[model samples]
Target: MIKKALAWLECGEIKRLDWYGHEGNPSQLLGDKQWPQRLLPLLITGKLQMRVPSIHTLGSYQNWLGYSGSNLAVQNPKLNISSIIKTKEPDFNELKFHLTGMAGDGNKGHIWLLRLMQELLNRENQTNKEITSNLRKVKLHFIGLEIDKSASLARELRYWGRAIMGENFDWTAHGNHQDTIRSMAKANIAVSCSKAETFSMASLEAMHLGNLLLRNRTGGWEEQLLDGINGFDLGETEQKPGKKEIELVHRLRNTLITPSKKLTAMSIAANKHSQIFQNIKYANWLLN
Candidate 1:
């Protein structure tokens, strides 16, 4: 719809109100591809522009620059969404599955994680608690949906419950499901042990829900998580030489065994961080 709408509109001097400045992969939230290189010239000539929080500096450019020249930067770390109305928590009567991408894609291994989650469930008549103890209180339900169904990532997630978990895992491949966002926000904890994420909407949503985040230390998760506070970020041997991934995973797993005593404080921090991109405040900077 947006592509069609943009195609119909005349580009000459018309007011441009867009979230992304140029075409982005959509899989990642890093701003548009052309914006940085394109904007450099415009910025020089005084036609191109952007806004920033007083606290940010040009040095922050290192965060989002991919392995390319004229790389894009993500200065605006926080998102600005519309006001979030109070929502009642839905009864998690079943296991909730959020497979993010296609099975074969190297970058989209979160789909495989979802499959692993389902396989963990299907083993020999295990009760919900036996399969996933943390989620024992809630029923097990699986969901497969994304912004684009035709996307390879979306397709891999579609087959999650069918092939892996069998009939026990409920599958909803393509549909406009509004409940997903709200539910994600209400989850007890946001598990984003993904292989890669420059900036994760998943982690932010979990933060909004007052849920502890468990993620690796690469990418945006490292920037977001304040260790032993709201969440945990794992480390690599190179950074902390001779360390192991299993060790990091084990440490995080052990931490989750005990419910957080500082849950309230962490929740407050998460909520506060979420507000940075909640209102139109973020838009004004980019437009102005």
Candidate 2:
């Protein structure tokens, strides 16, 4: 818009306006060092009205408000843009887990998952007075591979899975990637134990497959997840939901114990509610 306007209007004219872009600043086209310093200054000074999607260039793009900000509505009032939109998870109904190997490794939330599992198991055991009630209810399947593909992280994840499962837990560990995907397909719910995420593909994929998502609160997860509606959002300390992590664990246990059929109903609601946002709509808005 700015370019055509500039060409049509008189040369050497400048105007004060806002500019936006995705991933990186458009002024960077001038040159690496000079993009921000030289060219963007000219455009901003020259009255260019630039707008970019906040999700694509969130922290990097300047002059534009964050995508989640209210300014986008001001600029384009008619556009119905949502932050994070997902599809409903499938109705597996039977509580099964196919934790991705990639998740339980790296400097990510692997340890957090272990700790959460332990806490949940302890709580479940206390409830039934058997100490193994929770462990017995949940069956984990490790689908992604490790060492044969030359990934040390994979090997570590496999070892950790085995260690966590132990002899008493009714769990199985597999290294076949295809079998893992199949297991994920058959599972009732998907659990994402990620520490940091800009957006969650695993969580989204689980939603797409009609499996209810049980995930942590961080990054773009908040934008995508609708607590108590589509799925459960855990460990949030805010007053809106008014529950801490410990409380969230209790709620989770309560939900699980109600019967798989009830959970399946929640999963259906989750999948139905996730269709509000589409990537193409976001893309078109950006291009517009």
Candidate 3:
């Protein structure tokens, strides 16, 4: 079906072909022989125009083509800041760490949350602990929205999390947009474990709702998430929890036991950071 449409467009009287490329859906011309033979000639002849969300993706395509052309770096649509209602005070009796996205095969890297949970449990079991008494009283709950229910890896991870965390973890394989927003509202921190992302709408929404973002350093997340300010990056070089992750855990533990004033202040800072992605700014960029 895609081939037929491309063929028609190639032969038709169209002025130009505008295409959107990302990690998942790259240009067919950069792929196997079948489509490239049919599509590359047209693309090279100056008939094709492309738009990508990030410089990283644009560079990949440019390197593949061996030269730059009409590829434009138009970012993905930003979150609507107005729709998110900032909470003045969020209950921290049980520190809710929420992650929403696909889960399976480590594609979305949702399994990292499970790993972090295991690490926390291990620390709690240690004989000699330096953690404060108030920090020990703060419970942690992992809430996940698994967008892809059929993903085998995600399903397996969910089962493993339940087995380990028991009642401390909850996974909703099928959830609507509203359900995700509600989860964000109640969450103390929003976590993303994806190995890569063109742009993470889930993380952005979490920030808009004034939840501290705990995201991996990848994709457009770095653009909005400032370490130690709006959120903390889970390091880019390696996967395992290192100094940054340890510090983040410590901070979360401390935040849970801190007064509401400190939590509210953090929320306000996150909300301020999220303002750059407002719909008005996105509209102006698009228009220009």
Candidate 4:
């Protein structure tokens, strides 16, 4: 697929390429190690005009490729009909989390489920004790009906159910985009554990619908998601080498410690930030 796309960049007729970057790290995230080497020829020849979604990705590319060129730019991320999702009143009693994405995407593996499972197992096998009791208030909703159909995900979910067998937390999968939107509207937080992304549409849409996001600091996550104001950025803490899942789970528990009032304020800020995407479509912002 990449070969086919790159072929178009130098297919005799095209003068220059405006390559939009959507992946966080091609080497690690998308598992493509040779692309940077392949791109070097284009970069050196001044034929590749690289554009990325977030400021973070721009910086990352510069540092990774050591290319301090003038052909790169930060194109603002946008959403598609994001305002269709209606907002609802806050729910303080339970922490409802929504996670949505395509199931089979290589970088989009649902690794968070493993961290959650380890956390539950450490809490006395969901015995309704102090630790487990508090965690039971956490409900995770995996939106997009296709998630329920993924065989790979099914294996993780089976282990997930067994690990938290006696816990009261709700784990559900919804079928349609409307249902996904409704879930996001109702959720207190939205999560993404993708290894790499320029600026995830799920995170943007969730924020637009007034849901606090808990995601990594890849791409321009810092600019888009402000810690304690819009959402929590886990880039600094979650990416350590050989980090255990229990530690990740502990970080998740810490996120839940933020006061409900504070979270409400964060949600409001997220919604406000998302207004840019609602007003400006991606094509208009990128082209003209």
Alpha carbon lDDT at 195, candidate 2? 47
Candidate 4: tens digits of C-alpha lDDT, residues 22-54: 766645653565767777778788777777788
Encode model 3's per-residue lDDT on 1-288: one tens digit a residue: 556657667888565666666663365434764554555566667566556665545666665555465534455656765556556565555567787775545766666667776776666566244555545233333345444546677667767878778877776654667766776687777877777777677777887788877877666665767876776778672566665675567566663445556665666778787777674354443343
Model 1 clash tally? 12
Instruction: Please give the TM-score that candidate 2 achieves against the real structure.
Output: 0.59
lDDT of 2: 0.49
Candidate 1 structure quality by residue, lDDT tens digits, 134-168: 43322223333453644666555546546665564
Please give the TM-score that candidate 4 achieves against the real structure: 0.71
- Per-model TM values vs. the true structure: 0.52, 0.59, 0.77, 0.71
On TM-score, the candidate that comes out on top is 3
Ten-residue stretch with the least lDDT total in model 3: 136-145
- By the lDDT metric, which is better: model 2 or model 4? 4
lDDT of 1: 0.44
Give the local distance difference test score of model 4. Answer: 0.64
What does the lDDT read for residue 272 in candidate 2?
55
Better of 1 and 3 by lDDT: 3
